[model samples]
Target chain A: MSEVIIPNVTRDDRIGSVFNHLFRIIAESEKLEGKVLWNFQDVHFFHPFFVFPFSLYRYELSNKKNVECKGMNDVVQSYFSTIKFFDFMDLREIGDFNNVLKCYKEKSYTPICRFSLSDKNIERMQSIIKDVILQQIKLPINIESHLSYMLGEFVCNMEEHSQGKYGYIFSQYLKKEKSLYLCLADDGISIYSSYIFKEKHLDKIDEYESSALRLAKAGYSSKDRPEAENRGYGISTNSNLLVKGFGGAFFILSGGAFHREEAENNIFIELPKSIRWNGTIILMKIPLSEAKNVNLYKYMER
Target chain B: MKRNTIKLSTLLGENITSRSSLQILCNILKSNDVIDMSDIVFISRSVADELCYFEESYNIMFVGMSDFTRKMLSLVRKNRNKPRKRQEQDSKFVVCDDIETLLSVVSSI
Candidate 1:
């Protein structure tokens, strides 16, 4: 049994480095039949996107090695608590943090949810989101419809494309900023590999940048088979709606690539040298004031 | 030919997240001649994208779609027409038997 210290943890999405470290631990503990202490005493910035890869490796590592996470700051603790990330980590200290946003309660404006591939659950999730939108944001029926559709499309992307057992969604309404953050993540195939099987010339797509760009482009999909209609519009359309249509922010992080959209501009962020994400994460931020009554058609044309 | 009109919201029980509902709609479209997308107050782009598959076989018309849905449908249609480079013969990444295998390999990495 050996304890390892993880220091200088920040909101970095370089998941490869973290995984490499954990894999080293697994390799070290291959013969040991004792719990491995994973000390996080110096963890400062824990990004939400880290949750997906962390959840995946945590389960895998727990099979042979008893991995424990220790010493997290209050902010990191609160963020993890809000999304119940600690539950997946097997950290019993989760009760210490108070989550202000609870899902589905009438008084709560935000939802932190984990759902399965059941239709009833999907309906219930959408209803809760719609309720919050109606109460919190002042937008036309059409704009509301667009947002709802975007939510549905992303969730279905999880159901259809993500080969994972479950999906997670967490949203929060920031009072001071008047922005709503919606994050949906799944432990499934990376976007680059999703298209690799179905399309040709994917080799031209550099894993770090072009993978995210290809997903943001309209009519680019890995679901080009005869059984199901191509699902190119799920990410591409939502990207347009969130950024160009509503003046919000949109991001898709998968594997080592990160794509972000702000207003009319879309940027492909290069992944940090030693980072990789095992699944896909979609994060959207909507400023309710700017999203209302905007002409979505103009953006759709783009 | 009898006109078969299906309201997407009503057919989907106002829940757009369910792909089963899309399958139901696609199944119905196979037997009908016309589909009125007019009553659909809202439609997700993925659903709209699926509707384009029937464009060649069915006489699809939008009777009362709101501006947002109309634009979304047009976007799907327009995007469907764009061209792309064919898949390259030589590959660098490991090609898997299915998406499942590919995902498992990624997680193992």
Candidate 2:
């Protein structure tokens, strides 16, 4: 039996660091036979930041080999289980699993689960956003509208580009930090592949570096017919709202690339390369104060 | 012939998210001679772009939009045509502040 111990992956660490570590672990797991025991002995804290991307990894890995999680303390276990991370990966013997489920049922304001992106689901996500805004930051109803547009554009983009089965969205409000976190993950053709598949000019783009940054350009889209199509503005609009409008940070991980918006110039910084995110992870953090003063109408173009 | 009037916010509800809904509204704008945007509060960029496309087949005039909404529409039109701003300074999209101005503009058209 082969065993792999996962290091502590927490929000305090750079997201790239954790992803690179996971990439190495996944690469190593290929050598092991039978089920790989993924131990979390040193993992004292499991940050919500990694929840969506980790969930995607777990799903993709399950198809390749059996990976069992072990040695999780109550706090780490509860956080993972509460987000239904364990259940989605089909892991067994989750301690206090019922309690974690109870947390979601009780905290209807925050929904952490795997669901397809549809209009009904969009409303559910909007309600979660609305609740987070009201509780953490008092924002106008227009905030709900803005979040809805962003989420809708993201899901619609998934439907158009991701040739995968389902999309995942989860949101949580950090009470202490006075910030709201929203994450959307999908396991499908990533931004790089989508562009390469559709665009003619950049058929030979370096998957590791170029594809991720080009995704931020406003007019650029993966759709085949740009003149006849009103597509390709989803990611740009979301990025605009996050970095330029609300003055928050936007992070996108796709196709072996990590892109973060520079607060100074609003330009995307291509961080060090790691393992490719099979699909894509859109993680956003907006401060409470910014939410209250955000001008959705002013920020968004017609 | 009386120009057609459509309240975007009323037709699509206070917060519009569905792209198809905008398409349906665009259909109404096309079937009519002229469409007015009197009660629109906010429009997503995608939806705004779609409306811009509809302008090719329909005479679109925006009226009664708040400063925020008007600014968004103006920006969307400009951004949509950012590559051809110099050539197309006279964008087909017209925005009137009040119904009186909208009537006068519509009468001229």
TM-score top scorer: 2
Native contact fraction, candidates in order: 0.22, 0.11
Off by over 4 Å in 2: A13-17, A88-109, A117-142, A200-209, A224-231, A264-274, A290-294, A297-302, B1-14, B18-30, B33-42, B58-71, B84-109
Considering the two chains of model 2, state its CAPRI-style docking category: incorrect
Which stretches of model 1 miss by more than 4 angstroms?
A1-65, A69-83, A86-111, A117-124, A133-143, A206-219, A224-231, A261-274, B4-10, B17-20, B33-39, B60-71, B74-109
Steric clash pairs (candidate 1): A10-A45, A16-A276, A200-B87, A200-B88, A201-B87, A201-B88, A255-A277
C-alpha root-mean-square deviation, each candidate: 8.4, 13.5
What are the clashing pairs of model 2? A256-A276, A302-B76
Q: How many residue pairs clash in each candidate?
A: 7, 2
Q: Mind giving the per-residue lDDT tens digits that candidate 1 earns over A1-302?
A: 46666544333222222333433443444435668676667777543334444545565567666777777778867766655664541211222211222232333234345565544446545555565655554434435666676677787777776676666666555556566666777767776666665564375566454454454454456666444334566676567677766677776767656555565444454444344556777777766776556665554444
So what's the TM-score on candidate 1?
A: 0.67
Per-residue lDDT of A192 in model 2: 73
Candidate 1, lDDT over the whole model? 0.57
